[model samples]
Target: LRIRGGAVEAYDGAGGRRHWTHTRAGRRPLAVRPAPGHAFALWSDGLVTDTARTTGRTVHWHRAVPGLSRWLAAGGPGRAAGVLQALDRAARMLAVVTPQRIAAYRTRDGDLRWVLPAEPGCAFDARRTARTGGALLVAQPCGAGASWTAELVAVDDLGRIVPDRTPLRNGPPGDHARARKVVAGDR
Candidate 1:
């Protein structure tokens, strides 16, 4: 995501507590620094048609949004309430799309798993999440045009995509760049 401008905010640990910071005065997703010890996951946000900016001919800018920093706060470093569930199925890994951070976990033993993407912005949150055959099926953003495109992503028991990627367009980015953090869990 082209930050265009930089905006930052401090998040209150309390649920539903709201905070806002000024960016360069525009309607776009501003990159912010997480609490204290957050991590960032770099994955693909999928392709886009450049018909709106730079060239009307349509092309791809950076398929990757700025990596999100999952803060290492008091509760759980890079996690919410120290727990993450993909559709409430005990997520082996949690993906926060709004700010774009990924974290791996193991509950019983406090075993921590971290799957940091080497390639930036290759993953995105889906519109829905479901489980079939022990797989986590998530709708993810795919190609783009004037809208925010998406697709289905299935992570097998091994935590990997099967068909890898499939189209399921949700809508467009409009003027705002996609948020670094997506609402956690299946939509």
Candidate 2:
């Protein structure tokens, strides 16, 4: 099977005969992943497209946060929610990361699970992101001028910011002692 110009085509390998074609609507797909039961998860911008391999049927899943339409319309942090940063299939969550916030959705049906917002004037560093035991760990760089520090923050599967009991960093104790204090205070 191959996708071209928003169309999915399948040709018989033996005789090179055209088997079927399925046309999809919306922007081009950014990434495609195998889902349960011979289905595929295709994401583009903020839309989730699930296509069946056998029949080539399509289902478009729109990911959105409830009661945040006005905020999103006003150009709030949720405005950039479409840009996907990471996907955790085992956790059954589709994570979207921006400098301002992180949102997770159910990969099966594209339901909004949780949204983690950054502190005021602080931003999350997506480059150093890591996941452990279903938790998404992100480095948030926050502080005043000349005294800035990258603090480690962990978002649990339930979207709560919880302290990680296990050591995420391997550096000296002093390196993360102060960072732990900041993260602990949030709890």
Candidate 3:
């Protein structure tokens, strides 16, 4: 799912457009969670909208905290909740966040499994990383100006944060230039 022209649009496996839901009251969609089998969940204006895969229609809506749209629009950090598949377990789970924590839910029945406290005043965005063996990689951007920093955390399939992974740090200047030269030489 993606937001375009102030509407949230869902697409099919073949890249065909399925359905579009207009944002209510001029609020753009904050985040979209595309689940397996073409079904998806959208977050907008403190609400979670669930869509049916086969029918391309909304099934229901759930109330969440307000101000997520504005927060995300300003790149405040965390990602909108959605379904994540665990390849090892052969199951899909829903991942959502509150202002202070992150939680996981069973997709098959919307069952809550776990919740973890997030860093205060930071946004948690999850993405797949090669370093995590398919677990979700969470990044929190913090600080400002010359003191900017980002913290990295990994969450495994069972909703537990993986320990001991080192947080990323900004390298000295010219690191990118050297890395680019090395990459160019390899080719």
Candidate 4:
């Protein structure tokens, strides 16, 4: 799919035109990223998708945490920094990081599954660091002044944060380095 003039256009394998959806006015889409077998287009106010759009799929814009909305309203940097597919593709989950938090939603229906608080003053690095069992490791940079720290978070197939996992500290911010790099082949 390609976005042009605030619209999403889908093309066939032979490059033939398929269909298109014009994004809602005043909703500036910052990026378009691949989902499991489809794709998602991220807008400043919300998301617009050709592969997945249904009734009752609207996100409650008012429900977003105050800090996040404030950051977005302020046109904070790295607003579109992180977007990824959940390691468990069968779950059809999409993870997106705003300035203050990481949110997971059902890609097919746009149901919010979970939202994890992210480190303040940091941008979530979208790279996934392999898989551990049914969980995936996520990292972000938490810097104070000239010093930097890496905070690690883990989420399961259900999009819930896995607690008790120690945060990686004093590491190179946003490096792909991890304790293990086990690929979760074909669940």
The per-model lDDT (C-alpha) reads 0.31, 0.52, 0.49, 0.53
Candidate 4 residue-wise lDDT, 15-128, digit = tens: 675644545677665556644455566666554342532221333232223344344556664555554445464545566655456777655556565677765666655543
Question: Please, what is the TM-score per model?
Answer: 0.31, 0.50, 0.55, 0.57
10 residues in a row with least lDDT, candidate 4: 54-63
List where candidate 3 sits over 4 angstroms from the true fold.
12-27, 58-70, 73-91, 97-99, 120-131, 141-150, 162-187
Q: Candidate 1, residues 1-187: lDDT per residue as tens digits?
A: 1222332233345673434332323333322212112211121121111111221222222223233322222222222221223322433223333324333332222223334332244344432456786565555454453233235555532334434333222113242332222224457
Candidate 2: residue 148 Cα off by (Å)? 8.0
Q: What tens digits encode model 2's per-residue C-alpha lDDT throughout 1-187? A: 5555565565566897766665545654433444342233333334444455456655545553333333334553324333344344443456655567777765555656567788776776655677786566877778656243336667754555555443232223354432232144343
Native-to-model Cα distance after best TM-score fit, residue 151 in candidate 3, in Å: 2.7
Among all candidates shown, the one with the greatest lDDT = 4
Candidate 2's error at 51, in angstroms? 4.2
* Candidate 2 vs candidate 4, TM-score winner: 4
Q: Return the lDDT, model 4, position 131.
A: 68
lDDT of 2: 0.52
User: Model 1: how far is 143 from its true place, Å?
Assistant: 3.3
Clashes of each: 30, 0, 1, 0
Tell me, what's the RMSD of every candidate?
18.5, 10.8, 12.9, 10.0
